[model samples]
Target: EDKVVQSPLSLVVHEGDTVTLNCSYEVTNFRSLLWYKQEKKAPTFLFMLTSSGIEKKSGRLSSILDKKELFSILNITATQTGDSAIYLCAVRPGTASKLTFGTGTRLQVTL
Candidate 1:
């Protein structure tokens, strides 16, 4: 069975602090790894990594995939209190778009 694991299930930080979240997975015929930030009820898309060693970035958020290691990392820089949310990592295996999600990492950014 395919599986996804996230480390540091929860973290607390203050504004201006930087944080890194880790995710590891094992899947057959892996297609892509997706990152999402969940605030309130919906999870917003962050990044989708499909190639090894390539980093994807937007604003203060970035992510990279290490296919050789079967893992990925998400980095948030100068986090603000508004950045407080649950970070989710999911793996898409086979040809289907169906994703297997990790338990999630809850981040709390305070003043």
Candidate 2:
């Protein structure tokens, strides 16, 4: 079975603080690692790391993948209260578009 696990199930941060979320996985035929931010109805895509592209960044958020280590990390700098959300990590195989999701890391940013 393919699985992804995220550390620090919940975190509290003040505005302007930086945070890092960790994700480790054990997967069969792994093809890529995906990160998403869940705040409302559905998760919003943040990054997708594969063999050809192992790192991705956007504004205060960035993520990197290590296939050999079977893990990935997400970094958020200068977080604001608006950044409070559940961060999810998922893995996808070459044969399917469906992803196996982690339990998610909940972040709370206070002003």
Candidate 3:
């Protein structure tokens, strides 16, 4: 069975604080790693990493994959209250076309 674990399941930070979120996985044949931000009912796609060591970035968010170590990290800089949301990590397999999601990390940004 494929599994994912996210560290610091809950976090609180003030505006302008930089935070790093972690995700580790154990799977049979890893195809890709995906990050998402969930605010409302729908979750927004953040990034999808296929190759190891390559970093994906957008705005104040960035993520890097590590296939050898079976892990990934997400960084958010200059955080604001708008950044408060649940960060989700998912893993896809090379064989099956399904996604296995982690418990997710909840971030709270204060003024």
Candidate 4:
């Protein structure tokens, strides 16, 4: 069975704290890994890591993928209260565009 799992499930941190979100997966013929930030509505794409783009970074957010281990990690530095959101990780199967998403990690940043 192909699945993605995120650890901790929830986290609490103060403003300006750095946090690491972990995602591990098991899938057949994995094509890529995607990261999303969820607030109220649908998730918003944060990063897409493939063989070509193994590492993606923007502002205080960055993510990296490991094809060999079938996992990825997202790092956020200098997080603020506005950064509080649910982080999602998904795997794209080689045969489909649909992504199988992890349960998600809820991050709460206190002011």
Candidate 5:
């Protein structure tokens, strides 16, 4: 079974602070790692990492994959109060679309 683990289950930061969340996985036939931000009920897609050493970025959020280590990291810079949310990391195999999600990291960005 594919398993994912996230470090620092929760975080507290003030506005403008930068944070980095880590995700590591163990599985067979690794396919991709996906990052998502959940502010409310639904989770919004953040990044998808398939290749190692490649960085994916959007605005203040960026992510990179280390396929050799079977892990990935998501970084958020200049965070705002609105950035407070639960960040999720999921891994999917190449043969199927089913994803195994990690125990999310909860981030609280205060004013």
Candidate 6:
């Protein structure tokens, strides 16, 4: 069975703080790693990492994939209350278009 694990299931940080979220997986026919943020509504895509070493970035958020290690990490800098949300890590395995998601890491930024 495919398995994905995320660390620090919950976190509380002050505004302007930086955070790092982790995702590790073991599966067959590994394809890609994806990041998403969920609030009260549907989750929004953040990044899709397929190559190792190369980093994907957008504003204060960035993510990188390490195919050799079978894991990925998401970094958020200068976090704000608006950044507080459930961060999801998903992996696309094999030829299936479906994604397997982690339990997610909930972040709360306090002022």
Which is superior by lDDT, 3 or 4?
3
Cα lDDT of model 4 by residue, 28-86, tens digit: 78888899999988899999988743678999999998777777899999999988999
Candidate 1 per-residue lDDT, tens place, 4-107, comes to 99988999998999999999999989999999999999999999999999999999999999999999999999999999999999999976779999999999
Where's the lowest-lDDT run of ten residues in candidate 6? 1-10
Error of 3 at 36 (Å): 0.5
Task: Give per-model TM-scores.
Answer: 0.97, 0.94, 0.98, 0.95, 0.97, 0.97
Q: Against the correct fold, how does model 2 do in TM-score?
A: 0.94
Best by TM-score: 3
lDDT of 3 by residue, 1-111 (tens): 999999889999999999999999998888999999999779899999999988999999999999999999999999999999999999999999899999999999999
- Model 5, runs deviating above 4 Å: none
Candidate 1 TM-score versus the reference: 0.97
Score each candidate by Cα lDDT: 0.96, 0.92, 0.96, 0.91, 0.94, 0.94
Q: What TM-score would candidate 4 get against the native? A: 0.95
For model 3, the superposed segments whose C-alpha errors exceed 4 Å read: none
Model 6 per-residue lDDT tens digits across residues 1-111: 778899889999999999999999987899888999999999999999889999999999999999999999999999999999999999998788889999999999999
Worst 10 residues of 2 by lDDT: 48-57
Task: Quote the lDDT for 20 in model 6.
Answer: 96
Which window of ten consecutive residues has the lowest lDDT sum in model 5? 24-33
